[model samples]
Target: MRRRRTYRLTGGLAAAGLVLLGIPPAAAQEQGGLETQLRFSQRLTQEDGTLSTTTGLGVTLSSRTRTEAFLFSVDSGLEQDFDGSALQQKDPRLILSYSRESLSSALAADFSYRQSDVDALSEDDDISDGVLRLDEGLLKRYSGNLSLQLGRDAPFGGTVDLGYSAKTYSETSDPDLLDEESVNATVALRFDLDPRISAGLRSSFSQTDRDDPGQDTDSASIGGTLDFGVTKTLSTNAYLGYSRVTKSTPGFPEDVQKGLAYTLSFTELRPNGDLSGSLGSDIDEAGRRTTARLDRSLELPSGALRAGVGLSTSEDDDLRPLLSFSYDRGLKRGTFGVKLDQAFSTDSDGEEALNSDFRVTYRQELTPLSSLQAGVVLRDTDFVDDANTDSRKLQLDLVYRHALAEDWNLVGGYSHSISDKSDEDRDHSSKVFIGLEKATRWRF
Candidate 1:
């Protein structure tokens, strides 16, 4: 089963490439190929000052047949534990693709089981999911393209009420995170109205079934996009979407909710004129909402300078506004990028929910045979009245990637992160990890 799973994972990727590259599935019989990858990771963890070690493995395989292509992959890992027990996670995925001139389709199945000795909390969870997509050309107008798809999704985004319930309504509260199995159907349409204008619309509906965890939900969403060109080099795009969800189970908390999102972006670069910016926002029915996000980018000789601002307010009587900036530069060797963001609130309760994060990414070529990358991340989050009211985290990562042979490659990397909370000294935690990957492919 493991070997088959690995092969399937690789076959799936190869098949996807063939389809996108306009190669017919029948080519597998004419010219077959193989793909695979193996990876391993070592980890160390410390919580409340105590430390432990862990290791993980991942395998995937992919290939194609005359009429179909398949992929399968599996991952396993263990974590640190305080009571002489740790965590085990096993995830396996399989995908199949079939394609023809007029019709192309994909089926994906994912199964995951995780056991953790949150020994302190006594909680265990197991979950699995399957998804399918079928795409067919409906119409090709001189102005647009249209397509439709149908599939299944296990647990998507969860509601706060649900999160709170799952936390067993702890004094501070955490909701239900379980979203029952849902079937989905959608249609997307894109139009090139003119050389200077374009538009698109997408809508989907979902029906859920009851499961062991919590209430089921039915939902639907519709969104549209419009773009216009002011000049040969200046253009703008606007987008809007609305969605709603309703609980299916009878006694479920009135899990009725609606949300709306919007975004707009503009760019101009007609010599001497260097301007680009975007605005986005979301509003939800529960009053737990977000207002807007604003971003601007400037052309610079060194690289690109970008700035952004945002607003988010929860109906729970909390309000927050945020701002940030970023810069990216490309060198002969690689690229370097950095950004920082902070959220400021109006009230004390809101203040506790404020958060900030800073990060830097740098990549450079170490030699003709290898490349290296290093990054650091720091973040602070206010948890309000939760048992742990605040969290500060810092992490560092380094990676060396290289090609081993004509059809082989290797990658080594390490990452470590730490989180600290005030008052609850026991809530502090840290994790260190290292990993290596190698892969080879053969063609026939």
Candidate 2:
């Protein structure tokens, strides 16, 4: 099996150093329980780029759990970037939990809080942001043949967990930059509702406090999915969802996000030659940013292979299409695998502005006690979108692992990456890192 080398030895070193220095650890006895981690990385660029480095240390502790049905669970973690300014400071998470179930009825509730601080290179003011989320649901099972669920989901939590907003950070804080909060409700039911058909419904509301003059908005989404079995070897799942929002800025009071996404799958469910495929799309009344995808999977005798093709066209006159394939083979020593990806893109003018990315990876187990992996990656960008965008990129990485004991293990790794942009020379750069990590854990 292939695995990502985890960073644990860095934390141990810090812990050990404190002990040898006759210094008490920051929270040795200050809290609920002790679980911590540390990681360090370096970033560098060319004369056209820049170089940066960072180390990260984090600790999470929370009140003991009640364990009783309907009780809550509380947890929290504090992380600091040694690159100091790279990832900044993060206070991520708090979760509340409750659940109850019987032969015929059940209820559940959950909530969480998360937040973080941003870096300065993003051209905005330094800022603090996060979110709070709460949800509750009730379910019932009827005659061992039917089941139903009714629930409410609220994302009013002011945290930042969205993938799109992740890479974009601010150099400063703007108290006025609105946060996001949303609320939604969903209901679903299942049965041998016939041995062939089941249905569901969902409705949700969300609002954003965006920095773009035309981006701040509020919207509600309503959608559902259907699953049907056509035969013993084939089943299908299709979902259609839509949303409409009231914009926060003038001249645009309403915005709509509607789409149809679907999939068809076939499985031996018994292990011989399982296959599946899916097609989906997201388009609106204006078709400003459109996305489409086609995916397929094959269960080969050697292992399993999956492939996908997708295209995305955005309102800003940007178009991108991507392709990927992966294969997994179980070897006697372990599991071996490989993957590939490529993306082609153009500007609004339909001119080739950027051709980005191609990557391949391989992993193998040398023996019961040792394993290794090697991979290479490359990316190219026109930087037509922004001066900060990269015009070129190259990366390579290698890793090795060996076990010390059932609970103990050691790992070492090396990685290098480079990026260049046509518009900006000062921002071009390269990064290289070599590190080792080890871990040992036990349960009381």
Candidate 3:
């Protein structure tokens, strides 16, 4: 079961890569800049009636360069914690891209690399088809893509994209889950029927392979979409497609799955807010899944509010629900915000789980060069199939920042956290830190 869940995590990475390919690259400029920061802090933790203290130092550096046809950026950070359980961490990332345009066509290529914790990444940050998995531990990921478009200015346009991604996980207790890799290719064509209507046809193919478990999956799909404006503020889009998937695993029978998929969506734009809804089915590394979502947002006088609800069902007859809401408001002297989220899904070990989170934060300006911030977070998780596995966590934080110079600052913070589990005693921890930070930026 763990191996199967690991396979699903790799599938999410491929889906995330496809989403990245869909976004247009930023235009190149002639300016460049560099920024760096350094900080020192102390932390304390208590567990099983024992308290421990740790000191840490952190540094971050980032630089960006842009030219006529190329853009590049590098960001890296290092942290060293000195204590009995001392853990040294390094996170480095790089992005490079080149784009060229001609009279009738455009060509672009991009490459990116990053090393970080796997749970820190989220597919919900972009457009996704409900294929998401949660995993913890350190990971290194590399991705590259090439895209070309012909006749972009004409009534008919065509685009071709090819991409590859690989990920390796570390710091895991289970060594059976190793590395994963994938390759993807897509071709799409669009025809402009008129100024307000367009039709598109797209085809995609991908292959995913994993080590340790020795499994390979191949998937292919073709789809068409029609987008039309019904009125100045209203629009409708529809898509229909079919997909086929084949999976091969050692010591098991080969599995083949085929299904029909479709998506119908509507959006309305207003002066103060917007509303959108969609229903679709698509084939992912997990075979096939159907999903529906509704989202709404409103612009208040002082801030904004947003809410969303979603539902999904997989080919294994498992159903899940997702819900989220957030509101932010600005007062004369302070800002306040609150957010709530709930998700029902499978965990990394393929266990059924339900998780809920609630958070609230407030910030106020004490003076022109000083501010105070406070926040609280609460989480509840329950494992449906596992007995005595429910847990709850609560955390509170307060921070004060004061500017001492143009490029230097002082920060003091205090945090308290508590965790309670079924059939176990409660654990508590508290931390207080005062740190000085220096930041500088240079432009060229």
Q: Which candidate number maximizes lDDT?
A: 3
Q: Which digits, one per residue and each the tens of the lDDT, describe model 1 over residues 22-111?
A: 112223333356555555545444333444454555555556655445454445555444457545332212223333221233333323
Worst 10 residues of 2 by lDDT: 132-141
Predict model 2's lDDT versus the native.
Answer: 0.39
As for lDDT, the candidate ahead, 1 or 2, is 1
TM-score, candidate 1, is: 0.51
Winner of 2 and 3 under TM-score: 3
Superposed Cα RMSD, model 2: 12.5
Give the better candidate number (2 or 3) by lDDT: 3
lDDT of each: 0.46, 0.39, 0.62
Give the top-scoring candidate (TM-score): 3
Candidate 3 clashing pairs?
none
TM-score of 2: 0.52
Put down candidate 3 lDDT per residue, 155-183, tens digits, no spaces.
89999999998878876654434577879
The positional error of residue 413 in candidate 3, measured at the CA in angstroms, is 2.8
